[model samples]
Target: MPLGPPVPERAQRLLAQLERYGSREHGQLAVGRRLLAEHPDLPLDGFMISSSMCPEPGRPLHSLILRVGEHDTDGITAWARALATEPIIDGARHQLDTILDDIGIWASATISEADYDMDQAVFIPSGDDVSFTHRGLLVTEFGEDGDLLFSGHPPAREVLAATSAYYRDTCGQRLRAFDGRDLADSITRGWCRFVAYPTRTDWRIRSASQDTPGALPVTWMYAQEGDTQDLGDPVHCPACGRSSRGLDYDHVTGQRVHLCPSPVCRHQWPVDDAPDLEATEHRQDQRAALAAH
Candidate 1:
């Protein structure tokens, strides 16, 4: 059967995702074609693998069984790569896009979500006790219509909880550092703030972080701004009175509070995670500015 229009587009997106992160070996297009034949409607990319599960552990190249993206991107490839390395920046999106051009693809990034909203990047646990390959990031893309499209598995209780944790840690606590020369050093010696992905054993440390150290530590600093919520207030945004009923705090800071598509305000608040006097004032000024408009 001929591949449908969406099928090619979906493949493109998966490839782009993989390229952006520089994780895992590319998958065989033939395998992907066959897999697509099995589930023509499936929306997935990347593969999954682990170092411990590899015949050799900590050898770098031979440490992982890199499952799917050996030739193409799919869930499996996403899993393998995410589990393989530690992130260096706190709020930096993975540099996966760099590979897109090499793979005959282009990347387009959207603000997946407002800073204060719920967003996630998850690591699915591997079935194998020694597997280091099960991992992936789940991004929450909000629509102008006030709905959410969470990439990954179907929405459920566990998923929600896990997403919350991920949002808190990845975007909140942030991966502050990477160190040492290889995978083990990054994990044991604080080369990364996130260890939940690449389970230790499955990690194949081909080289040390020193061999190819990442950029600077990820930094996440928030202000006490906006309708600064009191320690006890649970019902409203203290800054502009944007309640939690149908709104969330915007985390993207072009240096101050910014109103997103959240209905309460068409305010020009700058997108950011800082919540302090300046952020609050910015929100207030944005609100006042919007009212004048």
Candidate 2:
């Protein structure tokens, strides 16, 4: 195979920069620092840089894999276009346009419940043993025979919105969508439980069995906001005697309930029965005031 055309002076500078600071651990941060100094007005959340081994073996390819956040996509697209005009190899020039196309797709792409056929679609959540390579939620779907149907790490915002819509419309209940980072934390904390629910279910949550190949975590089951439920005082689990700090859906009763976080207990009770932490604090303050008098 041909070694390709000579690299342009501009490409040489970029290649030198990549050599100096393009490692996975520090690449984005280094580029971000440069951008901040040079193009302070440009909006950027994060970016990635990767290069392939050339056909010659042991040599870096002329083309680079560059991906930027949506906020900086337009600016990066323009920059890539300008860079493409340099006297670089054909493959490098082609890669510039490919990068732009990828950015466009990422900007418009979304994972919606409507994208899948409800009759055959099932949502699979990340398991406790599963590790994440990125910050976003990884959505995976599998067929009945344990065949991979679809998988994508869609934007966390899109994933949350799609999940909320799916449960609200299909399950006949609106579930509070927790942040992807928080959900990941819940998994690490061992607060998540997986349950397989058929896309056509009538509000019945079923445990995953041999027949059910797909399963998704109930976000409400692991994390809860204080305002979402009214707990009159800090309620303790009857079984574990630990303060209830999360809400879980009781599939048997079809009601939201306060959940005990104890790994051994895993007990749940009615949400209405949960005591308000703020009220408990207020009452304690009153008792302390009387004692002071």
Candidate 3:
């Protein structure tokens, strides 16, 4: 068989590491550090060894076996050099775009609820729009008129547009019209508050809170700001009128309900039932301000 392109320097180093450490066992972090130090230009993130995984774990270099199309270590090493030298950032971006593309294709073709549920396999009606929670990463929304509101995050807006354009320009499929700022205020604010990033394993963007490393806070923060602001505040329970800090926000549904800090009261009601005076007053002030303007 004819020889292929020379193994890339980065892959060559990984091959060397695999030889020294063996492919089955975890290599020293120092090995990865040395590899990284050697190639300062390579992106610190997004390098890939295959479609579903990357070379970031123990014996990550051996992961090249997925790409090299061979089981033998020698063959894998020989082929790793020929792997594309594209920056891992590009790979990450490409994967993101691909996810957006999948979402766009599904949303564009989906006319009825059945159609939407067919491919995405997940849909939930939230407020005025319907959220297509496909794979729980790319949540595409549609308006009442069945228009594509938005998909993915702000950072990937361009990629989303390009995918929509591709459907329009190439496939002649007129994707539902989308607005640049169609994301719900809650989603927008939550996205702004949290950070999301993709991994080589998949295009899922892991979300972490702005203040700490965790999921985004419940949507109640966007529901009626003032009340949710003091997540921990003593308040009179609507059911028992007892003052307690038992109010807790459900992370999944984003609903705030009093847990009744006072064991005697044991009152539980949605935040709607026990509107905070401060929030009500704030809303009144806002209304007055708008009226004045």
Per-candidate RMSD, Å: 22.0, 17.9, 19.2
Error of 2 at 86 (Å): 12
What lDDT would each prediction earn against the true structure? 0.31, 0.39, 0.34
Give per-model TM-scores. 0.18, 0.20, 0.20
Report the poorest 10 consecutive residues by lDDT, candidate 2.
101-110
lDDT tens digits by residue: candidate 2, 1-293: 12134544444444455455545253443443343444444333333454444434433333333444433334554545443532112211112333232221111111223432333434344433222212344422222321111124344455445444433444444444231125323221112223222222211233343344554332221223212323344578988799865675554443456778789998988777655555456556656798999
lDDT of 3 by residue, 1-293 (tens): 11134555665555555445432243332333343455444332212222223433432222221222212223322222323222123211221111111111000010232222222322222332323332333333222322332333444444345434534444454332111123233233332121111212222222345564333332211111112123234567777776754445433344456566676777666767554555456556656798999
Candidate 1 per-residue C-alpha lDDT over 199-290 given as tens digits, one digit per residue, 9 for 90 to 100? 23222122124223331111111111112222232244445665432223343431443333346654544333445565456666767788
User: Which residue runs of candidate 3 sit more than 4 Å off their true CA positions?
Assistant: 1-12, 19-293
In model 1, what lDDT does residue 16 have? Answer: 46
lDDT of 3 at 168: 44
Clashing pairs in 3: 7-81, 8-81
Better of 1 and 3 by TM-score: 3
